[model samples]
Target: MIREAIEAFASRSPSRFAILVFAAIIALFTILLSLPAASADGTATNFPDAFFTATSMVCVAGLTTVDMATHWSPLGNAFVFLATQIGALGVLTLASILGAIIAGRLGLRARLMAASDTNPLRLHAGPVAEGQAIRLGEIGGLLATVAISALVIEVGVAIAVLPSVLATGYGLAESLWYSIFYSAMAFTNTGVTPNVEGLTPFAHDYWFLLMLMFGVTLGSIGFPVLYALSRNFRRRAKWSLHVKLTIVAWSALWILGTIAFLLLEQSNGATFRNMNPGEQVFQSGFMSTMARSGGFALIPTSELDSASLFLTDMLMFIGGGSASTAGGIKVTTIAVLLLAAFAEARGRSSIEIFQRRIPGDVLRLAVSVLLWGAVTVALATIVLLTMTDAPFEFVLFDVISGFGTVGLSTGVTANLPDPGVYLMALVMFMGRVGTVTLAAALAVTQKGQLFTRPEERPIVG
Candidate 1:
């Protein structure tokens, strides 16, 4: 009956179909997480807590309803591992496995139509010769690369950290399991770990934190950039146009983010009192980059000045890049928006970047996506602030973190009161599913005929 229902639903609108599949995955996760395998006493699990975990897992947002280490048994931890994998792969991508098979049997033309409908931009490019093949290869190759890269790093970390674990004189089994889970969480940016301290024991250490941060940076750079990098290095080819734009935008955002946070927080006694100038700079830059993607914290995030909070939020909103593990509006979207704003200021008709004019359709997409992101953030902030008595800055920080899929927090999420949880959950949902998908689902396509009308501008800015 469920299969019949799915088939029936898929026959209608595929976007809705995609949503339904995601819902099923959410249900699966909820059931697994809600299991009461932990033998700990004086603790009880509730629907809200489990449901919240399910949402966080499926979204890959890393916000938690329970202390993961204490609340979950080994089996429960294992479930979390699988949940992260599913969440990282994304329901849409996994759903495509089935969708593609069906579409293929339906014929290449039908498959192309389905693919084109799913991603509207592909259709606008004058129908490339091997569009479907390219899309399929890109999507599959990207996820496979992420999975493989994550495992490689995680295994390496496991081996390197094993000596430390062995020095503790514990059995190898416990150490091995903890190492595996910790590496997976860190690399995937899930932020949930078997360790109670959650990366604090290695806090001041250089290599340990660097490895986690590096994994996260790679994860957040988006699959498109990764694929481009791979092809460039492998084939000895020049970097593609997309790769250049992504690299430039990503570097600029982080450099500015690090500098902005350093200036904002250094003078503040709460954040920089104990650290020397060099340590302050290192901590600030590391914190800034990690906040954009990785959740690991070397210093206390709660004590940062208001300016630091605002800067972090801005970085989170811009996020990493599309098809990357990170969320937010993404680097390219913000880049396009920045150029658009510049063009408007210069009284230009179209936005241009890197001396190349952005096509009208691309500009429209950027504007549409950015509008939704702004509105969503505004709504989330308003709703979040109204319900909770927590400081507005803290809530805003977490909101951005949740939306960016960056797991770093200001310690505000642990005991979210009432509507705050719901608001953050919605923001995470938007971050995970993406504003583009939401916009496309609701966007109305208009038809232009032979009849035309003259336009007159009404007001000046």
Candidate 2:
């Protein structure tokens, strides 16, 4: 009976099915988290706080209404860690695995569903393209590759992080636990730390921060990108345009963001004032990396100057790569928009990059994603401002961070009322799964017009 229900649910449009799965998982976790055993004080948590935390965990957004180190018990922490993994793996990946297990083989419908959810770019490539055929095999291999790759990377990072954690004078068991927890959070890009101050204590520890940066970078780069690299490492096969663009955009954002942060925050006494040149350079780079869809912070965001906060908002809004643990409108969407503008400036009819023409459908999808994301963030901001005393800038920061699934906060998250907290959760869920899936789902429903209407011109700027 249960199998029948799952198969039926899986048969829906990929975006709707994906959203349903995420919502169901979040609901289950909310119930588990609201239990007395999930709290440190041996009392049941209020529904709003529990639901918010559960949403954050399952969305991999890392925004918290409660303190991570002090509020929850070991069982709660375990639940959070597990949810982070599940969220990062995503509903589509898990569903693919389960569907294969239940049916004893992956059907064409199931493959298309998983592919559409995880690698929507393939769908954009159209039906007769090699990408569509490749995706069928890719999804099957992705299940094992994603799970094993994440596990191995997390374990390796944990081992590297253990010595630093132990040197802080924690006992062996405690140090090991911290190591594992940090590893999971960093790799999953959830950014939930075992310490209340996050990575502040280890801010100067370059080695520790390096491992985390490595893990987060690898995780947010998208599984398809990584899989392509692994599969084509020694071969003469050409990398797909999607993989190439993702890598280029990913690198460009990190560099540009680092430079922007360094310049903007250089004079902020509360942030970079005490740090020397080398420390400043490293911290700026780290923060820039984290701002792009990473959840942890080494410095208090509230202390940064207004310009820096605004800059951080932009980076958070851009987020990380597509079809990965990271969220946001995606770098590819940004790339498409920029390329379109560039093409228009050159009086070209079609945007061309790397000898490939950008599809009109893809451009339309990009526009839709940008528009929806902006609207979602704006609506959340308006609601939070009305409900809480936080300034518009801080509220906007929280909203973009939630929408981008980048968990950095300006110390306003925990102070919000119940309505504000739920609003943030809605934005986070929408940011993580809702926007991307919704965009793709909407795109699939669009049919090319067979009949033409009279063309009209509107006044332009």
Candidate 3:
């Protein structure tokens, strides 16, 4: 009877099921974290702090009102690590994974639930095309890939960063644990540092920073792209348009952000002024990479110039790829909108990319995502501004960070009042689950119209 109820709920609304699952996880973690056993000083954490931390962890957003390295005890850290792993896998995907393990196979309903995480259209009441991110038949393989690839890459990263940690005068066991923690946080793009000093010690360690960057980039590029690349790495011509657009747009944004930071922050004494040209360039690259959902920082975000801060805001707002650990509207959405604009400029009616035509529905979805994301950030910013006396730039930056789940903050998040913290938590939740998924969850049902009204042309801009 219980199983039948769950099945009915999932069938009626997969998106709502996903949201409920995430909410339940956050609640569980909040309870665990609020316990005195989770704190370093053996005092119960206040409800607001505990709830916010749990939300950030479950959302894989690194924003925190507390010092992560010192505030959590070993058990609390364990809870955090587990939350990030579950969050990185996503609510529906993780549920499907457990369901598969329990049943030894996935049913059609299970596939539909998991597929909704990769492709939101699966939540709608219609047949989804095979050409979408991951087809129904391939969901099982995608799930395996999601689990296996995450483990392998994180292990590889830990191994790669171990030597650096050892060079810093740490014992073998401690070094190993720190390396593992860094690996998980970096690959998951949670951005929480294990060390209290954060990334300062490794600021000049190019190799270590580069390994973290590689992990962040891989994790940010969505699982579908990873699955596609794993199968078609040798045949570039066979790459799907989604994979191609993701790679092209992500790379382009990374380069642009790096150049922008280098030029804008080179003369700022607080960040890049003291560093030599080479050091400045390398640090700029690192900052640019981290701004895209990897939250590790060598310097405080408050030290950046206004222009650099604005640029970081843009990077955080656009964020990484869709259906990945990263947040924001997604790189693919921006890519689609750009393609549409180009088509319009060329006097073409249809959007085409990589010699493939994009459907009208995709463009519509992209527009919706963009608008929803902007509105979410705007509303959150307004609320936060009213709640605090912080500068507009800082408030907007933190709001976007929460919305993008990018985890970078200008010290605004740590000082927010309880009410503001709750609001930010809500933003992170919406940002992580995605605006489309939230919209689908709120919708009672999808209706179809049989009759069409006559279309009329309106005045243009």
Candidate 4:
């Protein structure tokens, strides 16, 4: 039956029929958690929390409706860990590539499967004559990016964080595990740290903070963007528009967001009240980056002043860049939206960038993505606030953070009612699966597919 479903999905379905595979991957972990031995405390669990974790995993959203590091058994935790790995790598269509490679089944279906992964918005080509090709090398490169990036950053974090964990007097192996767990915890932005009090214990520890900040920030910026940048650092002209836009917008936002945090929290401070200038800047800068869907924290969210928390919420809502590890609407999409607005302001008919015109279809899709993402985030935020005692702003912050897969919270995640966790898990699912794919699924099609409309005028200020 599963085989039949795969065949049907491969041949003809919603382009995002691929996402259903992600749903199953989410379900598998839930099943793992539901098993009698899944919980260390031997508590018989309902399927809801387990399902929530599954969605969280596949969506790459890290809200654990339950206490993850302690509540679940080792095996259960292992399943969650693997799910994070899959989600971090591409959750929807990428699995088919893995399944085929492992089974040695490179049939026509496999070829067609590979095609979907490499679509390019090549405006220079005028029209795409064919679907973009996907290569084994490219697929391997993606996996390698996720694996190597995760390892180097995670392992380095483990080593870097050792002094702090060791201060707890854990044995070598146990400290080793904590180090390893925190690495995964930070990078995956899963928020399920082995650290007893999460980042609370490491709040003022610089090296520990640095390790997590890097892990979460780098891991969220989808590897594709990084790969392009790493290879094209010397030639700005050769860089894809996507790469250029991502870096420009991300850098701008990070700088601006950092300042917002510092200004908002500087003097009213619980955490920052007595800190020197340099420490305050570092803390604000790091936390703002984490807010860009990284989810790491050098300071407790609870200690943040109300104004600072609002700034964090804005950062979380904006999230990270596209085709990158980060979530939210993506920096590139946001840039495109702003560029489109600018074009209109200047009385231009088409959105152009770096001297090249962005096709109307791409702009429309970008708008659609942001539009749907805004709606989803809004609805999710409302649901969370209704279900919990947390302040409206904090819940909105958590919702965006989770949806962006930025796992930072206002210290309220552990105390949420089951309904609250479930709402958050759903938001995370939408965020991670991505707004574009979700929008595509709902769209009315030409011959049942969406089509570009000719430019039209509407009144605007």
- Give the per-residue lDDT of model 4 (tens digit) for 396-439: 77777777777777766656787777777777877877766655
TM-score of 2: 0.94
Residue-level lDDT tens digits of model 3 in 1-461: 76667767776777787788889899999999999999999999999999999999999999999999999999999999999998999767876665555455797877987887777767774458757488888898999899888999999999999999999888999889889999999888899987877787787788999999999999999999999999989998878788888999999999999999999997898988888999988988899989999988887899899999999999999999877899988899999999999999999999997789998888888999999999999999998999889999999999999999989999999999999999999999999988988998899888889999999999998
Which structure is stronger by TM-score: 1 or 2? 2
TM-scores for all predictions: 0.86, 0.94, 0.98, 0.86
Clashing pairs in 1: 222-324
Weakest lDDT window of 10 consecutive positions for candidate 4: 118-127
- Number of colliding residue pairs in each model: 1, 0, 0, 9
After superposition, candidate 3 runs with Cα above 4 Å error:
98-104
lDDT of 1 by residue, 111-183 (tens): 3333432243543342443321235435555546656766676788777666555455557998788767766
Clashing pairs in 4: 220-325, 220-326, 221-324, 221-325, 222-324, 222-325, 445-448, 445-449, 446-449
Which candidate, 2 or 3, would have the higher lDDT against the true structure? Answer: 3
In candidate 2, what are the lDDT values of residues 348-401, reduced to their tens digit? 999888888877878887887899999999888887888888888998998998
Give per-model CA RMSD: 3.7, 2.3, 1.3, 3.8
Candidate 3 lDDT score at position 160: 99
Candidate 3, residue 113: Cα displacement in angstroms equals 2.1
Question: By lDDT, highest first, what's the ranking?
Answer: 3, 2, 4, 1
Off-target runs (Cα >4 Å) in candidate 1 are: 1-12, 38-44, 101-140, 160-171, 234-237, 344-350, 442-453
Reference-based lDDT, each prediction:
0.68, 0.82, 0.89, 0.69
